[model samples]
Target: MSKKGDFEAVRKDIAELMHQPEYDDGSAGPVLVRLAWHSAGTFDAETDTGGSNGAGMRYEAEGGDPANAGLQHARVFLEPVKDKHSWITYADLWTLAGVVAIKEMGGPTIAWKGGRTDYVDDSKLPPRGRLPDGAKGADHLRWIFYRMGFNDQEIVALSGAHNLGRCHSDRSGFEGAWVNNPTQFSNQYFRLLLSLQWRKKTLKSGIEQFVNFDEDSETELMMLPTDIALTQDKSFRKYVELYARDKERFFEDFSRVFAKLVELGIQRDADGNITNTDNEKGGYHA
Candidate 1:
């Protein structure tokens, strides 16, 4: 168990990292969020096979996975915190950094708990392909998220995270930000999904995606095929409208579901131990 005061130290550390002149706009904030999500996103509800406890993402076996492209920057950025607080596990540091990033970047406060322990090796890394692929549509979204124990409403809420950060060409082979203020989290993603007219375009990399078709739309933002699916699918579209019309509701749901997500496979086991076994697997991708 960690001392409560360490959380405050982490919060402060993350704040300092948010605006480093040497870094991305001095804001590693968005990528940190991605790190946390990818770390927790590996949970397999049925097999109880993977989750955020091990912070296995540090190993080449897991770090090298393409799903985690460009995320290495976040891990590298988080190292200073590790140096200062050697007692904290990388699992806890990564997740807690995300909590700080969300609040620092004008998003809702994420409820966080930290008791994860690191693993010894990569033997337990989750099998690859667990994370969502941006090129796929609603069906793929459902398949990927359902495996993680998220329902359609939760799926829609999670997808809204697209509002932050842009797809990197060297990373996901996709390009562009989902919203104008990529560093700030808001209902802008839902709003644009509701209002924008999107047109499909294939990038020079041979990737197919959508961009705002209107001349007046600021940012000329782009969307993944999966992003558009939120509106194209009736059930998902309803939530998109709800979130667009109500920012409070979006923030509330996002905070709750996101809390639920990072804690997956961590609650308890038959022996009263938390789910992080030595053959532990964990951490975020991209």
Candidate 2:
């Protein structure tokens, strides 16, 4: 077990676990990224309800949501790490794993601080349908992200995470990856979004998405309706175009915006300790 408060050891363990040869794309990084995003993305700024603090996904109410399908692989990947370091909260471990995975996958260095608790406050839990729908467009994107206090630029920057993972047909009812090299993080997603002529395709599952076949790679790349919506919207498109052209700028913006994302609804003291946390014992298993 790591010494108390030894987050560095936790970070190292997460790094070691990234080499999942049997997993999707031969790495657990992408799913770990998704797990962290889903864990924190439920935040509602107005209600001050959902965020990464509770680690509520361990329960059926949140975990059973259709939108969170396939994230179990991520949680399971981290379980051994959790067992190794029993002191770390699931909330903190999930978020930190994402930060570490991004860096391990050659992405920007995201700033993250740990103090989240495993305490599940029922009244504070976010209701179902809080996650953005991949089948939706610009208006739906705005409605979902705006509630989480993200602006159009931040929304575009966050969408860049798609460069990592592919959608599973059985899980999300969507198929294919956004970029050829899904494991490495880069501006390729934005670049492909601007450069490719994506044709609408309906899967056998009766799901709709946009696709572009790469002649060189002989592989089909895809974009969710929400991803296509970025280019279609004028405000969102500008950031996408900028990110496509300037990799450094995207890295900087993504680092800041993603840091803000994981920190949503978390109140902190001057010393950076999380203040608004339930310290009482008795919470769901994570």
Quote the RMSD, in angstroms, for model 2. Answer: 2.1
Tens digits of per-residue lDDT, candidate 1, 1-286, equal 2344366877788788888667554589989999999998988888876678788788776678899999989998898888887767788888889888988989999888766778644444688888888889999989988998999999999877887888888899988888877889899999998887889999998999999844655556898999998999999999999999999999999999999988887865654355455433432221
TM-score for candidate 2, residues paired by index: 0.98
Question: Whole-model Cα lDDT per candidate?
Answer: 0.83, 0.93
Q: What is the C-alpha RMSD of each candidate to the true structure, in Å?
A: 3.9, 2.1
In candidate 2, which residue ranges exceed 4 Å CA deviation? 282-286
* Minimal lDDT window, size 10, model 1: 277-286
Indicate which candidate wins on TM-score: 2
For residues 1-286, write the lDDT of model 2, one tens digit per residue. Answer: 9886789999999999999889878999999999999999999999999998888899999999999999999999999999999988999999999999999999999999888888888889999999999999999999999999999999999999999989999899999999999999999999999999999999988899999999999999999999999999999999999999999999999999989989999998888877777665532222
lDDT at position 28, candidate 1: 91
Model 1 alpha-carbon drift over 4 Å, by segment:
1-5, 120-124, 213-218, 269-286
Clashes of 2: 0
By lDDT, the best candidate is 2
